[model samples]
Target: MAESRNEPADPIVRGTFATAKQSWADLFKWKQRVAVTNDYGETYCEWQSPRPLRNPISLFAQLSARDWLFFLVGLAAWTADAFDFHALSIQTVKLAKYYDTSKTNVTTAITLTLLLRSIGAAMFGLAGDKFGRKYPMVVNMIVLGLLQVATIYSSTFTQFLAVRSLFGLFMGGVYGNAIAMALENCPVDARGLMSGILQQGYSLGYVIAASCNLGVGGSTDSWKTVFWIGTGLSIGVGLIRLLFPESKQFIAAKEAGGGHTSSSPRAFWIETRKMLAQQWRMCIYCIILMTFFNYFSHTSQDSYTTFMLTQKELNNAAASRASIIMKTGACVGGTIIGYISQWFGRRRAIIVSAIVSGLLIPAWILPTTERSLSATGFFMQFFVQGAWGVIPIHLNELSPPAYRSSFPGITYQLGNMISSPSAQIVNAIAEHRTVTAVDGQPAPAYGPTMGVATAIIALGIAVTTALGPERRGRQFELAKPAGVATADEIEVKGKLNDVESQVAVDGEKPDVGQMENVIVDDDDDDDEKKR
Candidate 1:
């Protein structure tokens, strides 16, 4: 029943916004529309009934043992990545003092890392597609662990920046591979829940980092201990990855002739070229989408604790406590909203979250006391990250199989690169407006600056997501490896991956196309049973 992609037909429709501004006159009336049809024959104004949402409990129960393993491993990798990165952000004040520099100078380390991650994503994502998911991921995690150790030993601000810049590259590579490893073979019925849980790894990392900050570095000059802890976790995650095999989706793709075609480096270039040639528009759109997303997250989070400590003049413990509360909300909200996205649709869920987040900006920033700020931070992040929960599955569904690693990873990192200076930009803006702290030192007006920036970014995300297409429940089972699946086949077959049949974990064969098997390995006799 899915549309074919072996040949070009028409673009998927979200709305007419993209084309409306081709000329000034047409732009004025761009909103006017006629009945138009997508390749799937769904009309623009069709009144379809809402898809029913799955019970969260039942959805979790449906996963096979392999599915759980893949999910947990991927989650750990992502969580560690976040933990390592946020350690730097959380220690900006201590880092500045340690290196005898301004807070902005210390924050430049964050900017440099963000700037270079696209390069890392490119390097490792190619390796992922060329080789397999496991080794490349292992390499990335190991390098990240080493870099964290290097950060702890940096003798100068320049050295610290250099180490973190290198760290960014390796850090950038993990997201694409992690999401692909976790969700590529996930059951269609459970993807929303899994996506939600996976995205929370970032928030979970922030919470853990805050807890560490409170426990290890509270009023102590020992920011080095935090970095050391991050290094240990990163190394531990790398080792953990070794215990799990490569993703079944990657295994099946390889066996079916995707990456298995050639061992030469040229094969990586050729495959990447072909994927971009067909999916360039989607890639560009995703980058633009990610630009707003990264801006929303970094703008809201990276400078928040500083804002609390410096501008609000709160104690270290109070700032850390508030951050933990905010990120905890982020974790809980992302999970709930991600699950809701299964039936509510990706774009709709994102827009709704964005709207609510924008509405909460006043309370998020206006609260003066630590207790009020903690409450506001919790609700604010709940919506901000609730929108983010949809991103993993949304991006995964948008990606072509051949370059699953490269497409999403590169695009996301590129977006990160574009928005890399968010903290600095906000800091620069805040510098123009100063306030006297209770301790008599001058502080930037971080609360007002962040409040304004978050509101605008929230609106931007809502509009962008509204105008973007959604591929909910897209198929993942392919008839052949990605190398053999033509553009036409990829586009037409979409997420279904041409797995015309499905076998359940219970050993009862489902009707053809009724369900997807999430745990079928290539060597299994049940390979056919899954698809």
Candidate 2:
């Protein structure tokens, strides 16, 4: 096995939140090192380095037909998940009025959904790992479709809450399975770009839901029609997935004896326990990264429109337009930044994006006019989601291949669970700082709350990402060594053929784990003296 400690240890140590301290010096320090050695025995060392940039177009060109198919299906499933989720959120007032209940009660349904999703993510993640990504995802979609339809027909607030809560469970499952299926089969070089595109499914779904609401929500109880539309789309995506074969990567892993050995539940749990023991640290790290990520996204976005409407005093039409602008920036930024991460390195790309996004918070929230708000929102999300675009690939690279579905999925959902209270926290803080409106009514100053929350979350993400390990361009496909019993321990599949083997002059192990297949072929020119 390759030694894993080639990269410099992160400065900000991770432990209990209360005990941890950020290393400000390390935050600005450049740590990457490049080395060169002479072929002839003249000097001890030679150093050369190449530019770390690559053409983005080549990222997509490297993928296969099957890779494209998997990416599309994965993107669609996640998009549908977003669509079904936001469908209820955008129509909360309508639902509350229809059911003759307080809006908070309706919002509680959203909370219930968030609270229960982690359970669903775990259960379905296990199923996907055990069975295959396809079937579990298909089942999740089907259930989501049924629940969405159920939500539409709910006659009582209790029924609506119950159905929506159930919807959250199935919704949680889709992300893990969808991302696993999409990126698992993808070429390693293309993963960053692909991840960027895939993550945008959420933004795309929001746009779709918004569009649907605009089209049908003018009449009384027209929100039901939106749910019906979301339902049909969910079922259609599930059926569409059935048309495709299981991910070749999953099939390969299964045939190579990756997951559980026996088809029994007992075996599944045993294997689960075994893998957990090996990957617990990685799991904790992933959950931490995801918590910051989720907070970064939700704190900035969930109350953005409210900030524009209540604080900036924009009307509904202006706020809606600004939202569109913001999400559009997200879609564009996620794709571009994801592509950039292929060359920039995942950690660097994410850190830079977070920092830039943090800097933009002032302009993002302080704008008084709708035009300024839209422009700032556009640029703000570009950086925010740009950082997010790398997450799917980043998580997959860190995950054990045997539990790719469960590991990333469960970690993501847990992060969601942890940050579920972000909006509430922001609301509470903003509500306490209410200002007198032009109409003599008290209104919360949402701008400053969002600005502060977004800035803090961005800085937190930067610290987490900088200190975190990266496996940029790590290979996803590797054959299990025979009699290995578990795929987790399987040796990386391919080797670098170009570099001739060279001994380490400094008697240090080469940074093998992080290198895709590139071995440093180095020879010390002063070898005789050294020897």
Candidate 3:
């Protein structure tokens, strides 16, 4: 036999190892590099690298003028959408009186608005993927503005309901599209803050609505004036949106034949099926959890604040004033929660807020003088329902880009649809309980029922947190890379690589200890793991 062969030069093996080492170095250096090679093309750079800038201050410093302007555009769109919704909130009680209906009937209208808005959201979501974000957003605004103008002339309950429901359809498009537009426009590192800031528009709109409704004096028709103002604002925004540029990512995806143009009926159906199969469970859970609590909170707090006050023996004017105070508190409270989420992380922030809100619900059941109840009502919105401040942002983040609009649209609408009926349920229950005007105190039954619902919903939220993913600072692309390894493939390849590398370095068989160490280190902690 020939002399025992010395190890060959193994140039290919050496080159592969060297390439791997370089890749490892780049990964550690905080720069991301992607090398793409096709039949006639090759390029490499740190185009996909994610920078580490977590705080608002850092985000502000780093964003370009274009990015800043895009953010402002997002804020304006969201503010307009939120302003329209909350204006309805302020006018709900007054509308009830105008229609010669109970507070419960008004609550039903609010519920229908939410439900129909979800339908609008789903329609726009599909449309956003089919067309582009820009045109659809403009369409939604124009439609909503027109509807608002029509709502001004709604003289009958059917006409009012029909106009509001139609408006809801377009309202759906506003939040989802605005969120998609905002998130896609921001740099990956600044995503959380930018998204959080955009969400603040809702609170700001609430404040504007409260101020406008409070300052303006009118009969039932005065509510029409509010709709007219909303119409004007929406129309102005729609004109601005018509001028806004399409997102770069959206444009690129379209150019690559990977976006709207590439979609086919068969492909769309398949994608829909996949989305339903993969995501429907989570969607159902979210809808159930959100519906129970959101309906309870909104109807009890926003929709029925005036009615609740009247039940407690306050005059109609006093009840209306009390509702304004509660809305003011909501504005202040929601803004605080938005900032707090930036600090504590979204999931934890929501969990803590929910629990605290649950604890505060029992306070509604306690005995209080009229003056005390009004005071409590003002702060109650700040604390007892503050968790909702984070919801629009939270729901948007929980979804994947592929079906972001669809998933949120379905779940949110479903929740609203389910909650719509609660107005009737709660009213029926309150009617059943005796309301002896003793010491100017309303019956405690409604409060106790609300408190129980709050606690149960809080528990549901806490449990859901266990199943929810932590996406606070992660890059959205990393969560769902284009044409990359599946999650399972990544796990398997990572394990095999560890084994092969360990065997090569030691010049011996792989040791179990090495495998054990890899398992322990690679496994994320339960609290920190992505959902």
- Best prediction by TM-score: 1
User: For residues 341-368, could you state the per-residue lDDT of candidate 1 as single tens digits?
Assistant: 8877777778899999999999998777
Arrange candidates, best lDDT first.
1, 2, 3
Query: What's the CA RMSD for each of the models?
Result: 11.1, 11.1, 14.6
What is the Cα-based TM-score of model 1?
Answer: 0.82
What TM-score does candidate 3 reach?
0.71
The number of residue pairs in model 1 that clash at the backbone is: 13
Whole-structure CA lDDT of model 2: 0.75
List residue ranges in candidate 3 displaced over 4 A: 1-55, 255-265, 312-325, 332-336, 339-343, 363-379, 383-386, 434-449, 477-531
Candidate 1: what lDDT?
0.80
lDDT against the true structure, per candidate, is: 0.80, 0.75, 0.62
- lDDT per residue for candidate 3 within 1-531, as digits (tens), equals 233223222121123346445533433333323333234443322223333336667767767776676667767877888778877766766787789987667766667787777678788877775566788888888888898888878889889888888877788787767766666667655555565566657656766666667566646657777777788888888888788687655566555422223344565667667766766655665677567556646545553544454456555455556666665666566656655665555656666777776666656545445555656665666654456666655676657556554556567666777676665566556656655554545453456555565577677765565344433443332222122233444565578797998789989988778778766655653225745
Question: What would the TM-scores of all predictions be?
Answer: 0.82, 0.80, 0.71
lDDT of 3 at 502: 73
Q: Write the per-residue lDDT of candidate 2 for residues 1-531, one digit (tens) a residue.
A: 332344434332334342122323333434423221234422221112213555767767778888888889899999999888777666655665688875445667767777778889999888887778888888889989998878878788778778877888888898888998898878766677789999999988877876787677345588889888899989999999988887787767556643633245665677678877766767888999998998898788876766666776766556667777888999999999988887666787899999999999888876677788889899999999999898998898878767778888889988888887776777668768986554557889777788888888889898887766655554556432112334322222222322223324445554565353332212232244369
Kindly report the root-mean-square deviation of model 1 from the true structure over all alpha carbons.
11.1
Model 2 stretches astray by more than 4 angstroms = 1-52, 100-102, 217-220, 257-264, 436-441, 479-531
